[model samples]
Target chain A: MWEIARSNKRKSVIFVFLMALLLVLMGGVFGEHFAQSAETGLLVAFVIWVILSIIAYFQGRNVFLAVSGAHKIRKEDHPRLFNIVEEMTIASLLPAIPEIYIIDDPAPNAFAVGRKPDSAAVAVTSGLLNTLNRDELQGVIAHEIGHIINRDTLFMSMLGVMLGSIVILSEIARRSLFFGGGRRRTRTSSSGGGQIQVILMIAGLVLMLLAPILARLIYLAASRKREYLADASAAIFTRLPEGLASALEKISVSPIRLRKINQVTAPMYTINPLQNMKLAEDSLFSTHPSTLNRVRILRSMAGGSGYDAYDAAFRAVTGQTRAIIPPSALKTAHATVPSRSRRSDPKSDPGTDQTKQAPSAMGMAGAVLTAAVLMDAAAEPVTPAAKVRETTDAIWKSRGYRFIPCPCGAALKVPPDYRRTDIVCLRCGRKHPAASAS
Target chain B: MECPVCRESMIVIEYDDIELDYCVGCMGVWFDAGEIELMLGKSGIPFPSEALRFRVADTDARELRRPCPLCGKTMQKVCPEHGRVILDRCPAGEGIWFDAGEIREVIKESAGAAGDIVLGALRRYLGEALAEK
Candidate 1:
């Protein structure tokens, strides 16, 4: 994992240099041909880069979050989410817990952003919180933290800002040329040197059209790699490949669309937030790798929750292992194969894994019981047991357990274990069928 | 925004830039004008692009009529996605009101290629646990 992070850092540096060179060349050509000053073109490009860099450095996360309609949330606003994030942070040994936010949109999606781990923020959609259970949510959160730990968010957001600027600049250039703003210069430049200059100008124009596309391809390629590395980190941190694998399945399969996602920031999400945009799995322009392929790689990791096991699974699933998880990382990885069946009644269900620990009602109860016992032993009641139970219930309700609103104005929660088809509302004694509540 | 039915102050909830008027007392939501469309956009399902459109005839089954919260004018009955999901829209086109969990139902049942894919993937990946039945 360290090796992967190092390589990512190295590649990021190279990409930055490449982007700068492209900008300088394009700007120099535009100045020399149109403005009659290479200095002017270079200055314009430099200024654009500087401005975009400042924006990305200071407010990139905010811009993306705002665009996605995410609002900052306190721990009290969502204790279950806070708890899961806290767990992932502790497990990863992150210096500080990332600020949490929730988008009101029903799309089951999540992303992390910040230049550094301590400053990072993780945001998940309301739909995601509703759809995924505890383990699945943890898997997704761990993956986001992986991006933070690997320092991928900075590079990814920087690339987004740069690539977006290039696209905008290209659009402006194309429009100016299309409207004949350069026709006067072309007509006057009839000298031999002028012809060479004109040719260079045309070449530059062609490059302008192609540069953004090329930049995007490079960005997507890098984005895909970062995703795989994050997955590996998530599994390594949680020691539960199936948790994230199932989560990947749920997220990808969710048709809920993000209201404000675009090509630039799409790569930052756990799964491509815009996967519903109809891009092919292996399309050169796709932001993330095929979620199906990702799920397969995760599912194949039967050995252990180590980099080596993940590498083996990735190799078995993708047939080429050279690009992701490096050899050095595998050497340090442990050899304990993870238990695939961690819960009872595995064979009866083929679709969703009903592992007792994966956020089911029963599992939630078990967690509460364990926490209560630990708190009792500690003799320090930071959060009252009743408070913990209420929060747990709130989490379940958020995940779509039926809440019965009685005439007495109190909302009665229908417990998941109630076997009777009809039951009286505990608060108002109103009889209602169980099926109607859902 | 206030709830038309309960006449209670509604909480202003933000989903992206789209703000919803949510009634705490009744657990209802009001989407002003294009707010529902904005929320629907997040679902990534394309707006109706076909030449021929299908509409479900209004049955007026919901007898409890609530006036428009924005204008206090009587609202029209609207079944946005077939007749299964009924909502009240202002006659003046101001907004629509939905009780709590109706949006979830709309999202869950909306038929589209993307929705089908996710549902199929869920079944394949999680099996019986995903099927509520």
Candidate 2:
């Protein structure tokens, strides 16, 4: 895990430097075009890059939180969520519990921010709190905490600010191009310096046009790798990879899109909120890996939810012998094989995990049927947050409960203490016949 | 904002930055048009086309119709196609009114897409027989 953080830091430092260089070049072009001097342009661009980096380093997280409409929440507002976050903080062994904030939008998403774990903040949408059960919510929080522990939040914020500048600079340059940039400065008719100036202008123009795209591609690549590491960390923290796998499945398939998230902040989210745009899951432009692929890897873990198990599952599913986790980390890793092992079971093999998890022909037909039912139901939530919480106990029991639909549309909620064979509906005074399981 | 249902003065409850008006008597909440749009917008998801318009020419609506507290016009009864909750939207684009428990239903419906995603995958991969087992 430390190796993952080290590698991410190394990659991010390189990425940030490249972005800084791009910013300087953009600044130089703008300065040279306006001031008509090569040396002055480079100096001005360098200054601009430094100023922007300083601003991003100091206040980027605040700007990001404000832009996302995140506001701090007292523990009283949502005690359950607060407690879960507290639990994750301890599990991740952070020095201090990060502050929590909530975004009122119904989209289920969460992200961590700030320069370090001690100063970090985690924000979740109201929709996330309402949708996920306690265990699933814990899983999500653990994932965010993983990002904090791995120092991905600081790197992500820095990248966002730099990329933001690139986009802004490009926009300004594009406008200048359209507006003719205050009339091209006329120079001496036959000079080698003038020829160099023209070449520089063309080069700057080309860089300005391509910088945003380049930054975005690099940002996506960096973000996807961090997401995998965060997932691994989350598994280790929760010691229940299935929980996060289920949460991801829910988040990816969610219909409600986050309202405040844009391209700049999209990579910070647990699942890319823009994914509903229906880009190919495996496309390079995607900020996160395919949700199905992530879930498959998590579920395929044979025993302990450790980094090694995740790394092994990752390789097995990806069909690559190369390890995702660093070799240095693997040396000290715990190897846990499930106690109830079946060597002859083909389905249990890592090599065939994907094949076993892949959708069957009948399942495709079933999905179509499910989609139709969903469309008819519209986007209405089938279960309330409170009710979902009730089912969370099923995770431990490994048993399902049957709901007896009452005439008044409310289900007869059989409490754990209910001893009668017939459960009374609270909404309408109707008595429904139910199994006396409670 | 006063509750259209009970006409009682509403108390403001702050959830993050969103200040929602909740009626003390009826517990119905009033959300301004801008607030609704802001919430919908920030969620980074597109709003359903049907919910955008405040007033429609066809006025015959469901029985739960109530006057908009701000405009005094009979609010249109809107049942989101995907939701079982019936929300009262103002004709003048002022705001929408949600009865006490309606919002919970709407939230649950908002989760349907995710539910489908999880259930769909499980059904497709495991098959009904194995899934049941």
DockQ of each: 0.05, 0.04
Considering summed lDDT, which 10 consecutive residues are worst modelled in model 1 chain B?
B48-57
Residue A253 of model 2 has an lDDT of 74
Off by over 4 Å in 1: A1-3, A276-280, A321-323, A333-407, A411-438, B2-8, B11-88, B91-133
**Model 1 per-residue lDDT tens digits across residues A287-386:** 7888887888888987367677788888888788474675556555232324333333235332233243343554321221111111112111143433
Can you write out model 2's per-residue Cα lDDT over A241-319, one digit (the tens) per residue? 7778888888777888888868988899898888855324556889988787788888888755766788889988767
What do the candidate models score in CA lDDT, each in turn?
Answer: 0.68, 0.66
Angstrom error at residue A319, model 1: 1.1
